[model samples]
Target chain A: MSQAACIVGIGETDFCRKPGSGMSQLALQLRAATAAIQDAGLTPRVIDGIMPFPNLGRAEQFAANLGCENLRFAATIHTGGAAPVASLQAAATAVNAGMATHVLLPAGWNGYSGARVRQTVSQDVASIPGGAIARDYYLPFGFTAPPQWYSVMARRHMYEFGTTPEQLGTIAVTMRKHAQLNPKAVMHGRSMTLDDYLASPMLADPYRFFDCCLETDGAAAVVVTSAERARDLAAKPIQIMSGACGQPYPADEITNRKDFFRTGLSIAAPEAFGKAGIGPSDVDFAMIYDCFTFELLQQLEEAGFCKRGEGGHFVEGGRIELGGELPVNTHGGLLSEAHVLGMSHITEAVRQLRGEAEGRQVEGAEIGVVTGWGDFGDGSIAILRR
Target chain B: MSEYTKPLPELEGHTKDFYGFCKQGELHFQRCSACGTWRHVPRELCAECGSWDWEWARSSGRGEVYTWTVVGRALHPAFQQSCPYAPTVIELEEGVRLLSEVLDVAPEALEIGMPVEVVFEAVTDEITLPKFKRVAAS
Candidate 1:
């Protein structure tokens, strides 16, 4: 078996903000998996491995529904939003180890319809990420949601580095602008300006409404196989050059971290870029996990796109816009695009590499990076090449 | 006071003593005897030294505001009444940080590195939360 792996195919269901799709989570997962398999020019029986997102569904059920005859490898990633990007590493490892020829990674959730973060906090303490710390420490003070939890870091960043709300607004405006080009984006038709972003109601301190990612109901899947096998595949294979996952100390809790500003991407990014034998400058674009605007800025710094405390300036002056130095979130990202748990980031990267992104395509894009931020600060990065 | 409608801490085996100390009007954190490191959200073993031998060391109940967020909109149904409350992260003098709210301070008044002292709020008969208040400058 060859050591190299490539993403052979990608697929996703329509991104929605409500449960009106009339499809169960499992049905959505299978639909995406089927589309991905078909896009690879392979039947369901040929898919030998599965990497299912935790809590979405089980591998066995996915295999049974997809009609896989011989399911060789099966595993689930538990790093929250980071799971999708990290699954590329797992799939690459499995394929390179001769354990599986083709691995299907599927991620989807009823984020808006089924269990919103507000509702999930009250459901079961065990189900929530950092459940113990959240129930005991955060909830009692009414710090229940992602916006509240992440706002602490955002405020600290501003205090330490003088990151203004306008810098954050630029990100929200840029993403919404990109969304206008992407019909699949949840906020495609809705344009936003920096003034509008500043005018948006504040959800938490240092974080306005536009700073938050859409609570999307969606699913996306990708097929990974050895680069050697990819030659015989139908789709233009996007090489999975390097993938890495990292967790900050005390990954579950946020308040106790030694350097509250440092995130898991700080550790994962260098390792991934090094493994790929490249630096941040070599990439043509980036599909950064934009769970929040501040997070996107933080990841850019941590991912080595710019120096620490310089992310605000790095994103300024249309540097991250389309046709800029490094186009980011060409599919509008989680902020304007539907939040598919960062799986959409992966698919968008593939589309860009394959030159399939119609209006948002970066001209002659060869290298692209995608990142995922999950739980408190767990991060994953995958460097892809054409 | 009216009934405490918000979510309360689930007293696990490891966390019960920490809450118990709060109920007694004291703030305590698990300190590793070997490494002399303090930890919060009480855990069984030391994260730094991996030692199970630890003690519930009393805190001076004084800390500084490490960071905070004024939730403009309540994510929880109960907090809707208390819209725009600041949930603060306080770094204690002992060098451990915990999540709590700074009482009697406006959201704009809260500053990073502002001195604060712990205050126990008995929300329910069984649960006592350790919150914070600004320390007046001498």
Candidate 2:
């Protein structure tokens, strides 16, 4: 069997409320892509493969603008936030198949500065056009925005497992603390108390103002290559031991899923761990996606960090904090850091495994996991090791 | 009462039958003729057997609340006056769930497994939405 591919380089733009540059979306992508190429100690000419998260930006446009001399392979995966890990899986597959040597994956969004800002409040936010899932079923009943759809599961988790708002508050509080150590975080230096969380106005019931991820304008990129090539790169190679994306039955339509509290990660976790030849117990730390604090709670259970429905209590007393066991989102995930569609989580995992995560580093961390949740709990997991 | 301001379902393809039945004030779902499995959101293939064969079965409109959330924020201008409406999932006796607006009840009063019955409201001259009302305990 071929050896696992490695993340040779990772780069991110200044994460902020608005990217002050007048650059188009493609320009932001090229900046991150060029930075990643330079970080890998390779010129853009060596990049022969391009894999982008579906529909964020055009792969051909990136290859052309970034000056990739040999764009031998290009593909994209669409699962919303799940696209990050899915792109990693595609890179591994392409590299292992000898389809390309160096692969670039770039993600960028101007969510705050672009017209997309209005999308967050629109009932038609993020739904597939001409699709029954949103147009026919959800939008008709005001199940429109991402927060609204996720709140159904949050309420169900509360009803089924008696998960308290305070437990979920721990996740938000912990992420903010992590963000304090990350200068690039949008919410950096903005401290939050559990009481602050409780007092924040309700955006959707069960989700206070702090419960939602920030609308950010930023970009991040990653470079994947053969493990052998990674050894020759500037940064320590973070091996992609395993990457997988999946969903449980009735995946897209949240209301129809068999178990509302359970995410697709329930199915994806074992698949990733099994492929990595490791289990959840082997993970030293992790970067579970936190688009919403409750998502982190549910993902903790789905990723086998705790028993089903016990995630609320698992987060209590700072278990996921920086100094605690299984320190997650060490760079303050999408919740506190920036929502680059979970690509930031992947870069944080690379940083933690490489021992480059300056202040928020998990002590002596060797093995770690990154997870993505999107589109009504469709999940993706990637297990990485130094 | 003023007509509901939220967007109404656009009838097309598989959803035509669903709204057609709702226009007549009857809740309908597809039960696979081959596998006898019930499905929602009105699709063609059987969820269990992969059979394209199915029939429109009328729902008794009697079910219990499986789970729900009160959308405190209005996602659209139409819902501005209707903030704090509870959009719920009602698990009908047929064992398939449907998303509907819950009416005649305060969000605080809604609970899991609470009994509910369907009520059709004409939002427009052409569209009649099927919502749910709390069924008082006997």
Candidate 3:
């Protein structure tokens, strides 16, 4: 079999929830993408494939603007939060199958402290126009927003699993501490105590003020090429070992889900471990998405990192900290880092593998797993190794 | 449809799940005649035995807390006032989980294995959403 497709180059522009330059979204993509090509030491002419997550300044629109020639492949993948890893895997498949040698997976957005601070600023909030989640169960409940719709699971997790708001707050504080070491993080150095968590006003019971992910304006891009090409181009090569991704149980009603506590990630985990040829215990660093703290715990438990209901104790014991057993979200995750959606985590994994993370790098990290998690239980996992 | 908030969803004219007892202010689920499995969402077919044949019966609406979360972020337009509401999945006595709202209790008071019973909230003129209240017993 052909060797696994590898990430040859990764590039990102400066993050800003709001930029005054009035720079069009396409301009942001061009600059960041150009940086990626440069980082990989290749000309834009080498790019033969493009996989754009929908929320990014429209893929076809960007391609038309960039005047890309010989574009053999161009498409969009629609899984809400799992699109990042899915896109990477798609490109890897194309490359491994010789459909294309170079693939560009790009996504970015400004979800926070933007000039337009209104919630209705963009039609695209890193969500599909009318995905299965939107078209059916959630839309009727007026749950157009993800945090609102997903809070039910967190609340239920609290009720059934005995997870606490303090534990939830601990998830936020942990990411914040990790962010303190990441200059790019939006919530860095802004840690909250359990008291602060419980005292903070409620957005939903069980979930506190600090129990949500931060939405920031930023853009990140990733470049994928065959393993042999990556070995020749970059000084460091991070092997894209395997990926496990899928949507929620489709037959399961969007609203009347059988178990709100469990997710498709629970289903995706075993397949991922099977593909990676390792169990959860072998993972040295984990970049589990913290779109919400509840998701962090749910994903950890479902992915077989620990048994069910042990997430709170696992986190309370400080196992997720910078030097802990399995340092997660060293880039502060989507919680403390930036939620230009989950693309940043993918880039961070590449950075960690390259040993470029200045301070938050896991000690002698050999195996890193990054997960794209959120949006009513749609997610994916990427296992990377040095 | 006219815009009016109802505490309960309209169950009339809906197929499956709630037995006649719910119309009489009770909750119910379908039991598999072959496997004795209780199924929620009022399926037209039994999930357990893959039998289209099933039976409906009134349930105590009592069960243990399965899992739940409190939404801190206001996501729904209808839930603008309901932001930070607790949504839960309760495992009923008949062995079926139903997603509904929880009420008359603090988050700290809610726990796994806590005894809970169904309570309906009047949301719209024609609808009442099934919610749960702690029963003070496991």
Candidate 4:
């Protein structure tokens, strides 16, 4: 909140199921990082800060690859899917503090081509055995994967709010429709109907195959700098109007949390909107993370877009479609688009603000909100304005 | 059900008593001796009172099915043969929650707020797993 920080560039690697070309994570990250720098009409030499998602370590490797001469600040966030935009908070802080000039924010994962398949049956995964507090409590009861773990929350939502599977299916259907317009989307050209969603095999109770996001292999990067620098750059500056990351009490474990129906976003949205000098109604569009369909619905309600328990009705009737009020995930989202750990959601918001979202543009869009959800209950939100 | 081995919980300093009670076929929770706050998944100190002084208080094992999921897909080698199983979270009468496998009812029949009670199953020589079965409506 000191000096305004702005996102001046956005870039991403091609969406692929498998990078059989032996595409390492570093290669994917550098490609997006280079593209983002070039997109901002700035050279890598100007980048002095880097905020990366976990596993993409050491800013020096990135600086070396980008030809950046002075990498002054570097940090990595491991807050699950929420880290990408959540990381922007740290970058903006550094930029506001004058600790760094331009910062590169990147996220990518080879879930399809990498350890995802190998990890399906392997017990060697460190995080699997008594790694997290929640795991220690839930694993013994046969709650192994996310689908099973999150199903508890999903079922509760249904019981408390009468949220139906069809309502959840609406989200998947809406995202797939949006992906149809985005050529870069992994599910582009592949259509899904509500029937398909209902018919999809159940991974866990209340979660069918369509309820989950794709295990994608891709990366996205954004360039953040001072508002002054952003204005001189090539892309229209997306002002960091407001941003926050929060975890409510007992956030470490789902069972220990006070209210499963409420998430950290319930606390964060007010802070973010207040900082932006706006409200959820004032926002033109949203890029809510869709790690699962239930999460999408819950976040919408928790973010104050609708009354709690009303997200099911709010998303109905094509309200979240491209031409609907507060169009969401115009670039398909993780469900249909490539899951770049929600960084691509940031990129999509940038595109919408710049009027560059060709087929999926929300007309007269000047303000957009992007969000991230992870770590059982950690939530992050940011409001951007053109 | 076919016999198999799965990853078990580590019975450390804080968790030993909780599982030790399980070996005796009794459900117990960590209650802060100072503040009388009930806690689950055993911790070193009480969250409410920040007091390390606590005692393993026996639970009545009577609770309602708060939420549940039927994992149609197997995630671990131990569960490969049990392709579809129900994992449930039960909120005990004492206002504390714990995770366990739900049995004696079809997955589709599981409902929120349904009464349930705990039953122990000795899965391995060293570890006894706690499970839940739906209580008949009185």
Candidate 4 residue lDDT tens string, A1-386: 43579999999888879553268888888888888988999999989999878665568788888888898999887667788878887788788889999999988868788767334523533543225454456766777777776778998988888999999999999999999999999899899999999999988878998998898788899999988777677888888988898875666567656577767788888899988888899989999999899899888998999998899999999899988987989998989998888999999999999999998889999889999987665789999888
Candidate 3 docking class:
acceptable
Q: Of 2 and 4, which scores higher on DockQ? A: 2
TM-score of each: 0.97, 0.96, 0.81, 0.96
TM-score of chain A of each: 0.97, 0.96, 0.91, 0.95
Candidate 2 docking quality: incorrect, acceptable, medium or high? medium
- List the TM values for chain B, per candidate: 0.95, 0.92, 0.81, 0.91
Best by TM-score: 1
Question: C-alpha displacement of A208 in model 2, angstroms?
Answer: 1.1
lDDT of 4 at A189: 88
Model 1 chain A weakest 10-residue run by lDDT:
A118-127
Model 3, range A1-386, lDDT digits (tens) per residue? 23777887787876645543246556766666777777888777778888887655565665666556657887777776678877777888888888887788877654554433225521233343334323222333344455555666666566567887778888888887888898877665576666766787766555555777766666777788888788789547678888877667533344445555567677777887898899999998888877778888888998889898889888987889989988888988877777756778888888888888888788788888888764457778878887
- 10 residues in a row with least lDDT, candidate 2 chain B: B1-10
Question: Relative to the unseen true structure, what is the C-alpha lDDT of residue A82 in candidate 4, on a scale of 0 to 100?
Answer: 81
Each candidate structure's count of clashing pairs: 0, 0, 36, 0
RMSD of each: 1.5, 2.0, 4.6, 2.1
Give the 10-residue window scoring lowest on summed lDDT in candidate 3 chain A: A121-130
lDDT of 2 by residue, A208-323 (tens): 88898988788889999998888778888889999988875777677776666666788889899998889888889989989898999888898899998899989998889988
- For model 2, what is the C-alpha lDDT against the true structure? 0.83
Docking class of 1: high
